[model samples]
Target: MSAALVWFRRDLRDHDHAALYHALKAHTQVYCAFVFDRAILDALPSRRDRRVEFIHASLIELDAALRARGGGLIVRHADAREAIPPLALELGASAVYANHDYEPAALARDDAVRGALGAAGLAFHTFKDQVIFEKSEVLTGAGKPFSVFTPYRNAWRKALTPFHLKAYPVERYAAHLAAPPAASIPSLAELGFAPSNLAELKLPCGMRGARQLFDDFRQRIADYGRARDFPAVKGVSYLSIHLRFGTISIRELARFAQEQANEGAEVWLNELIWRDFYQQVLWYRPDVVTQSFRSEYDAVQWEEGEAAERLFAAWCEARTGYPIVDAAMRQLNQTGWMHNRLRMVVASFLTKDLGIHWLRGERYFADTLNDYDLAANNGGWQWAASTGCDAQPWFRIFNPVTQSQRFDAQGRFIRRYLPELADLPDKLIHEPWLMSAIDQSAYRCTLGRDYPKPIVDHAAARERTLARFKAVRPTGD
Candidate 1:
């Protein structure tokens, strides 16, 4: 009776799970397990990390679901490199299965785990589950990886088929799920983590939560393009965190998007394609994990220490005196998320306006965002900072005030997050300090005191950023 271990990593759900489905089909008996992986956790700055809390809750839900199928998830709080091989030997499993993780660190860790398992005489198998198209799949006509998105997206759509959207029929092999000797899930405190403050935030957890959110988004899918920019509106699908962990199926989401490819669905699908493009970028150009995507951009000088710190603190704390920028930061600090447009706004402010290194802002977002993925987060930061392949030109720096006025015409999103700016009239809220003395007095706010004045004048910073780019830019062009 050959037994197989299904090692759950980011793919936390039971339905349509590629690795689990393969394991159940090939083996007579199967066991499932999840490791808390201290190698990853100890690096995290906070004990109350919301991503941890979300994973913990998802694991509990997974354990419960497995129990209903006459099996249980063996939860452990150790490094995967040490935990998996020994557990495979102990259970006499012939093989172990898992989904691919494209992050450089994860790829290295998986290699080590596979080597260890092979040394212990166990087969290690991996499947591509997280993405529809990956490294070299949707390439240029010349067979090179695409650095541009439009051609890549077109190639992706042309290559996608029903097979790509087919759900793995895990339920068909449910009988193979072994009735493992029962083990209990460790409590958050027991595993060296405390309950997160996210409890009050009521973030949806697990497969059930993902489904509920997806259903709600379907009703408003048409308005996604228009609404996703507004922080106060439910324009964007909050499915990013779910997509990050694979608590939800990418196939289902993509299939749904394909079915609805109206103006809204098409916009949403483009975002998903961007998600895949970034993953493939990370897979093919793993150096992007630490360095700029466009090497030439690295020559640009950055302001560091006291000045950078002051600007970063203002950006993070949502006191940048630019309402849209402030609102975006407040959303991230308060809820661990931000609208996509605001991500661009804040990143431009950091890289172009403050003249700080893009890496610093990228790391800050990594620390704060619940939906942070290595590839997408890094790609976004690089794109905003003009340091990535196909990045926005450095000279085209966003005017934060104009961005606010254009996106939040009524200042509804800004007022919701920055209460101090709430009383300012619609026209003046975006740049309250720019208002006349009479308007400023009526609003009961002053630039230097009530809100910090703009850290750097935009026009001056724009010229400075442009000149810096020119210094390193290609001499011929």
Candidate 2:
């Protein structure tokens, strides 16, 4: 009987998994394995990374799930390129199956693994599972990848069929799941990582965790459109981390959104479409990871030297003296999660207000965010910087105070993250430094001592930003 090995990557769950289902159907014996690739782990800056902890927890659940199905995952802790081929040889597997990973580094790694497996007389097969439509599956009428989002989203919707959203029934071939020798899933310490605040934050992990979050989100999804923008409110799915790790399937989320048919569901579905859009963008233009999508924008000058370093440090530490910006940064530092509106606000503040390079912020987010997907994070930073496809106009700078006033009008979100400014009235909460000395005394909030004064004048920064971006503007206007 033929044997196949299913290498688990981002798609971690057992159900509705494309590679697993395909392997089960085609091979008489199907084996599952996961590699804690050192190539990725060793590059991480922190040993207390939440993503690593979350993955560790998810893998435990995955192992248990596979065991219940009369099989167990072969866990490894080597570079995937070296680990996968040898494992296939040891198992005498004829094929190695896995889901697609579109990032350039991952693509290169997959190519190497494929080559090694081919040389060893094993077929390497990959399926599109992480996204609903990937890699030119939904393209423009001219058969080119669409750079614009709205049209691409429209095309994605048009191309959607029942078959596209259908779940793979791996259980139909459960008999083929081979019972492998028991292996212990590694702990955080075993992986040379320390415990993170992920447990304290109480964000769920694994398929069970994904289900819990989705069940809660389903009830509130009808209000998502209006409530999602407010950081104080519980409106968003909180499933982004799940999506990034593939603990939950995209098809499951999209199908639910479509069936709901409310304004909130539709808006949320639009978000899923945006995820697809960014994926395809990365697939088509890999250079965007480092360079601006529009080459002209690369000419824009950013702040540098000691002053720029100080500004970035302030932004990272939530001491920029702008309540919303500080609050957002603090949220990221404390929880590894930031509200979507605040993400845009802080990104614009970084690239436009501070005159810092977007790549710097992108790298910071990649290091910090629990849901950090390279394409989405890069696309978002570049979009905020007005250097990406279909980006916001450079002239449209976000006013931090106004954004705070609008989104967190009552100062609920700001107070949650920046308690130093909590006693300030709503009028001054968005701009705590604006309060008079007498008012500050009355509120028990001192600008320099309790919090900080605005690092730079907003009006002055606006003019400087306008001038800075003008250098990269198209010749005519």
Candidate 3:
């Protein structure tokens, strides 16, 4: 009957989906399915994970969307490497279709699935749906993959055409979609998870939620350039979670950014290009998953022993005594999202100020962020550590007080998470430790009692960090 199975992964939405579109176009009967892969879910540190909850909520919407179009999602909760091939065979499908995933672990899973499907005489097909430009799509003048972002972004801009931004017209072949089953999706408990605060958080789920956020952000996109850096303002698009999960398409976002022709939109578009940049890096140098991108940076001696462990615990618990860093960590713990600006600040504080390793912070973010994409998160931590392509300079440390004053001045964002420091005047909020003992008594806040004192002085730490990096700096530069 020329049947094909469409396997949904990170791209959860129904419309304009690359694999679904292609599957429908080529088959007389196309069935869609989503597996809550146990390999990923079981490895999570907490069962109350917001990302898992987000995916669960999104699948409900996706299932409904497909049902409305004469198809529904075949939901399964199992190891995908063991589940997909048999399911495709049971459905009498000759091929399995999916979108590409670039993470080395994900790539390995795909390879396993492909091999199993091939042994069963079923072809496995994958398409590029996540990014507009993938590995080798945009390159240097000599056709080498770009290590630096600016030149790559310029090339990405020059390579952009209307075709790349065009959506896949899935509606064209919807008639071929097979009818859906009449079963409801599994509950959170059924999936071995507890209810998360995902609904309470402003981070919406599913295609409808994605559209809502995008529509609102569209109205304010002109202000994005000046507004994104400030955590207190609603200046940036809160659509990152949507972008990470493919509830919204990259083409749609990029297309709008290109049309705006404004500085704000252009800057946002560059950020989108950065997604592709990291993706290609992961594709080319999977070794970066462990080793530093610049091998020289790997030679530096990171702080070790009980003291380093204590520092990491404080950073994780939001007890760093640096207001901005602690506030940012608080935000990440309470909610699964952090502001991009704060992400950089916290990463800098963790690696540079505390002199801990970047991998530890990267792993922490991997467990925490609702929109955690491997490529972006890894690239970001590496950038902050100054050990990645086009990373921040190793000597350039972020002063936690300065970052707080600059981005959260007036203490609006800091107050939101660290309410204990709420009573301090805006002038004293960024560095409350600066207050005299009498002033602390007056404000009803104490330095060491109410709030922990700064664990390491930023100035002293900066000098030590410089010396550590200097020991490993390449001879020429």
The candidate, 1 or 2, that scores higher on lDDT is: 2
Question: Which is the better candidate, 2 or 3, if ranked by lDDT?
Answer: 2
How does each model score on TM-score? Answer: 0.98, 0.99, 0.99
Per-residue C-alpha lDDT of model 3 across residues 1-477, encoded as one tens digit per residue: 799999999899988899999999999999998899999999999989998889888999998888899898898899999999999998999999999999999999999999999999999999999999998999898989999999999999999999999999999999889864555678889989998887787667899999999999999999999999999899989888998889999999999999997899999999999999999998999988887999899998999999999999999999999989888999999998899999999999999989999999999999999889999998999999999999998989999999899898899998998998989999999988889989898888898889999999999999999999999999875
Report lDDT (CA) for all predictions.
Answer: 0.89, 0.93, 0.92
As for candidate 3, its clashing pairs are: none
Q: Write the per-residue lDDT of candidate 1 for residues 393-453, one digit (tens) a residue.
A: 8779999999998888899998888887779888788878777778768888777877777
Stretches of model 3 off by over 4 angstroms after superposition? 181-183
Lowest lDDT 10-residue stretch of candidate 3: 178-187
RMSD of each: 1.3, 0.9, 0.9
Q: What is the lDDT of residue 354 in candidate 3?
A: 91
lDDT of 2 by residue, 1-477 (tens): 999999999988999999999999999999999999999999999999999999999999998898899888888888999999999998889999999999999999999999999999899999999899999799888999999999998989999998989999988998899876667777788889999999899989999999999999999999999999999999899999999999999999999998896899999999999999999999999999999999888888899999999999999999899999999999999999999999999999998899999999999999999999999999999999999998999899999999999999999999989898888899999988779989989999888898988888888999999999897799774
Rank list by lDDT: 2, 3, 1
Regions more than 4 Å wrong, model 2: none
